[model samples]
Target chain A: MTPHDDTQQAQTRAAQEPIAISERELTVMTAHLEEAHQATLPVMHDAIADWDERLRSENDPAELAEMRARFGRPSRRGFLIGAGATLGGLVLAACSSSDGKKSSGPATTNTKAAAGGGLATDLKIAALAAALENTAVATYQAGINAATAGKLGTVPPAIVTFATTVQQQHKDHAAAWNAIITGAGKPAVTGVDTTVNDGVVQPAFAQVTDVAGLAKLALSLEDAAGATYLSVIPVVSDPGGVKTVATIQPVEMQHAAILNFVLGQYPVPNAFAKTDGARTLTDKIG
Target chain B: MTIDEQELAELTSRSRDVHNDAMRETREPLSEIVEVGREHRAHDEIDPLAGREFAKQRNLQLGKRVGLLGGVGIGAALLGLFDQPAFADKPSDIQMLQTSASIEVLAIAAYTAVLGLPFAGSLPAVVQTFVTTTKDQHMQHLQAFNAAATALGGKAQSMADPVLAKVVEAAKPGLTGPGPVLDLAIELENTAAETYVANTGALEDENAKKVTASIMGVEAQHVSVLLAVQALLSGGLVDQIALPPPNLSALPAAAGGVGFPNAFYKTDLARAADEGAVK
Candidate 1:
């Protein structure tokens, strides 16, 4: 007999000998079951416990209220346990419908929802990302022009070489983003968005012209660009686009770190990039 | 019209079958939800519960059969949960963090040994400064990883002395001058960067991934500076102007350089080596 036939026979045999569980023992059995569940899924237990702690400690009235509304009150362990039991019931129903025959196919389907927004939002985000890259290109160009014109007084030649290399990378990034946007049939942005240049870049440049100043400006630009990519990754509709952004973001952070080192700071300052609370892509482009 | 004993037994058996079936269907989705919950909890973010409502609805439909089965269904469900893939694997996050901490420990030991080398004192002041600063950073990283691991209920891992010995021994062949020493530093930084990148995706905790990536960014920067220093020491920048520039002349000819080496960072070298991917 085939393995499938064996499985069918075993399932049929099991179905005939149902355990007669008394209703009075249900609670005790459930407690045992919950214990087994926790032992089996300790990571999940820890996660749920962590969430519970957060919910209890949340101080903001509005945020606390929101959490309560979404997840119910913080002290709802009993309710959660009940929910788990209910879910088990549902699984049993499904199994019964299939006559207790488990499919030999792959167990889990991809659960990720389709990208968060529509194509238009994707285009907007892509354009904004492209704009940030363009600004980086332009900023680097401006720095290079200053160095060539001898405006960066006493800046080392090696520093100029470094800036030139970094500038080329920004150009590559800009081109890549433009390709992504144009490939989507969106009108490619023609030039660097001066909004970021005016608001952040120029002001930064006006404050410093030496190698130190240039490094500072470059660092800020890289930080902001990195932050923007990070902010957009979760919101972008295209999985490919999200992957692209994730790939690019590390490079930007790398640039920031190198610049930090150039300015006589620790290369790895923080354990995580300060991507939160930074300007968004829209904020930068506008 | 009274039900016979056979009929009652058959009814009970059918109810048990339904209960068992529902238990089977619920396991996979619940496990997924738990995984998502773990990730969100790590990040201190809200659980999205994107697919949770469907599971709930399915359970609600089976509510009557569930009532009949009493705690039997719960017992079966727990059994199913135990069989889930998420539970099947060992807790990888703590293990990964412990591994990372051990790597950091290795780094600290290697750097400390390098500093203690006879020729190290005569190296350029900038080189000395770089070595000390980097070593301090590794020490900090080691402490941080240990703290994180401990907080996660995992034991802190110390640097494997044998691994450190092996690394130092490997560098002995090139210890003749500062040039070789710098090259070795570059190699170590690249490996660290590649390891962090490769392992970042395997991390179950979002915060752990972020921490790893942040360290990776630093490692990449270290590679860049080390490459630049190597170029300077080699008399002049040869082939440094190429877009994405060539890897440091010290590195193998096939290796890519400091200028954003690849569109996507290559990962898994360190991990693969650790898992005996290397002969």
Candidate 2:
């Protein structure tokens, strides 16, 4: 059989099999989610505290009460429900039997396909993001290597240093995604998808021989990366996953803004960053 | 529970009166308010049981004076109450938009005031342009937010608040040169960014969360650019842009002075106070 046919058959076989997640795996996933949720609380609490102090200092008891009621404290209920649903969904997805027989209470056969669909979607998205990061790491490394070889003609030393730092950040982002996949009991994608590298990164790299060209390319890449993250966030089911995606998105925007300045463009270009050109690596590759 | 004609008429009258009062306070047209009220009435009719359930959910225990409008359905009265600027007992989506709009107004005013400074004239052309561009962006954001708030049957807040103005005035003495002015801009952008970030988590509507996230991204960009300018003016190389340390102990000497200075952007009050964005 051809490779495409073989892949399709494999997918069909995987879907037909009864999937299961161990209790230990569930515990590990829950722990990761709880840790992420805890990390976000302090940031939120700090904002609420500032508002409280401002209202208190104003001596407006009414407004102070209102502020207190508005953002009292971070509720763990939403996080717990969200995390539970995420784990439950994944578990249900995996435990789904192809025979269409109903499972016992609290785990229905009806939700099996839907939950599995969601988990699959999340995995695909994570893979796409990881692939993009791999491409970014490769791109930056290429630039860095060229600079070291004194072949990045007319590129400023500052831009080279910035590239080195950003390269490491992309590496961290890639590693984070791989960890998420591995933690979910999926095989981690280790390298940049060749199609993405060829279609997007390679074309951009081919056009940039000097500092200005590299800055322009970097701006485009960063903008696309930021836009993709923002777009994917709402679709991601896990709140912890949303937070992880959000944590990295702003840094990409930061990189883009700095590059814009390097290109003599306005740094803060818009009040709302546009996600006009957002595309997953899968989309590009496909 | 079909027809109570007298009670229904009384409810409609009370609704119009309360809505008119809101209109007078906000100086917005009454047609929009009436339209929103009609929409709520339709919703109540569609889900009559939900009206009583919603009322029970609120468990409003206020005095009789602030109670339901002459025995009107709690849902209908609550809808009317939502339009009122004074009734902030419960926070909702529109209130969040208004709060964000108010901050955007403050940003515009702060930028305008900074541009008026004598030192502003001596700054580079690019810096002046940056200030103007950022102020215009804030104005655009304010307009979008105000429109959203008004469309939701709520009053749009003023573009300037005396309270926020006083806060700005308190910081005026520190605006000695371009460096300090840029620092002030950085502080404002940081708060704005954090506020937007915090709201994204708080907002119930998914669209609102996404829109707020988009705004937060731009706000971070503003902070990044401002910090870069601040660094360049201080005779630091552009390569000095380093990531904020993950641990507080490893913080650089000029903590909060660099763009993206924190590994994770904090949305807490303590950080805002430390950053001097608030009192």
Candidate 3:
């Protein structure tokens, strides 16, 4: 045989040579791996437990409560008194006002009853939702800024087309949400550091400096917004408004799915679970 | 009162279906929200794929795509090693890294948010592992960011907010059921992974981008594990895999003008304000 033929034969023989790992042994190995995997989780619980301990021991309940009030439930307390008086007054004022331009303000007479005798908490949720909508609005604006800064002899047609489309969606959502907040007599959630922690917003844009990245960020933010709405919907007093928020959820899910697909990643299923690992679209492959 | 068997089973079924649906379909509903939401906007002006014009013009380029596009021969030659001097011109690298670190902190908060849920007390072993390790990964990511930043002459960050505190509160055992916690974890990890992968192209040092890519990989694994655990706790199959299936980028246009025509949108904030989705 020629040298090439001999080498080829040897390579083929090596490829077929698998004599070890009986079925029983393989099952044991798989079980062991799964066991290890299962066992590795408790360590996480312990850490969370430790965190809970620290929170319970060190955090002043009063101060925590206050913070929760300011950040989490600011409008809830005010809502009980605020809703009845404001909705009637605003609706009248809006009706009397000849300007077809309705109150884009948070107190816009659009009352969606809360899930459990809807109170101020719905307003807070709505405010946060509006805030999120605003953030999304800002993100698309930033995308335009990024594109503008990188002025081109001829910008990529795809980038131009997609960016504009996504931007319009964010704007519309923000406007729609703003109208909701205003009709309720709540202050419109203006764009002032809508990034969750009041951290810089532009850098988030900078980090994901590609069209796909921008799309993904939009999807992520939209998903978070959807979750916020879902979590809040059941608690709102107005079932109709709850229906509106609920309607919004599946749409946000679709946005995330589309963005995930664009980035060569997959969309997640659960809208409410914040920790589902389905968000890691890029990490699963090579 | 604890969630009953029927309730728990329902949660399990829903979570499984959501996971399954995501795996099966290229397009779900969220994109439509964004697409419908931004119908009036313009496009992002910069095209990342334009290679030499849009990207390399910035400064010393070291990302994988940069290497591939600048010159195949040159890129291939420098495949294994990164040139540090090339990164000297860009200060924004530090800013982006810090942004990533901040995101990591946000993740830690989200994963731990379950602590406040009423049912956190009796988390199954698998669910607990999924949550804790995911948090650990976030912590590790924070540390990695710090280490990488320090290596590059940037200081570690120290920003705190009520959001992180709230997340920790949410993570308290027996505070709530596992479903919500899993949901939050998924959202944060997806954001982080997408953010990192997107930035992979911008890093001037190919090595740094590689580091970012590796973190994205880990984050993705975290996603899969979390999905499985949620599925399992809700009584899903142990071997079930939850991924994005077809990535979000490739989805076709939504019917009746619902989803985005493309991913990026470029309208001004003022115009967006006019659109009424935000105030």
* Position A282, candidate 2: lDDT: 30
Worst 10 residues of 1 chain A by lDDT: A85-94
Worst 10 residues of 2 chain A by lDDT: A80-89
TM-score, per-candidate, Cα-based: 0.53, 0.60, 0.31
Mark the regions of model 3 whose C-alpha exceeds 4 Å error after superposition.
Answer: A1-117, A151-156, A192-197, A268-286, B1-279
Each predicted complex: what DockQ? 0.05, 0.11, 0.04
For residue B186, model 3's alpha carbon misses the true position, in angstroms, by 27
User: Which CAPRI quality tier does the interface of model 2 achieve?
Assistant: incorrect
Best by DockQ: 2
Q: Write the per-residue lDDT of candidate 1 for residues A1-286, one digit (tens) a residue.
A: 4323433343333334332222223334334433432332332233224333333443356543432332221221111001221110000011212221112111100001211244444444555566667677667666665655568775443354355446656665665565654454334543444456666776788776676788888888888777666445445544445445555677787777567655654444443444432343223232
Candidate 2: tens digits of C-alpha lDDT, residues B1-279: 122335434434443454344223222222343455357546653333433333233223111222211232333533443343332332254555676777788899899988888878767555665677678767766765566555544567665533344556677898888877876687677667766665555544455455566677777888887865665556432233222211222212222223544435545311111111111
Per-residue lDDT over B67-159 for candidate 3, one digit per residue giving the tens place of the 0 to 100 score? 111232334333322322222222444444555676777677666666545566566533443455456556756766555544444455544
iRMS values in order, in angstroms? 28.0, 18.2, 21.0
Candidate 3 docking class: incorrect
Write out the backbone clash pairs for model 2. Answer: A19-A94, A46-B268, A46-B269, A47-B267, A47-B268, A47-B269, A50-B269
User: Tens digit of lDDT per residue, candidate 1, span B145-183?
Assistant: 555555544567775423333655666776877677876
lDDT of 2 at A191: 47
Candidate with the greatest lDDT versus the true structure: 2
Fnat of all models, as shown: 0.10, 0.23, 0.08
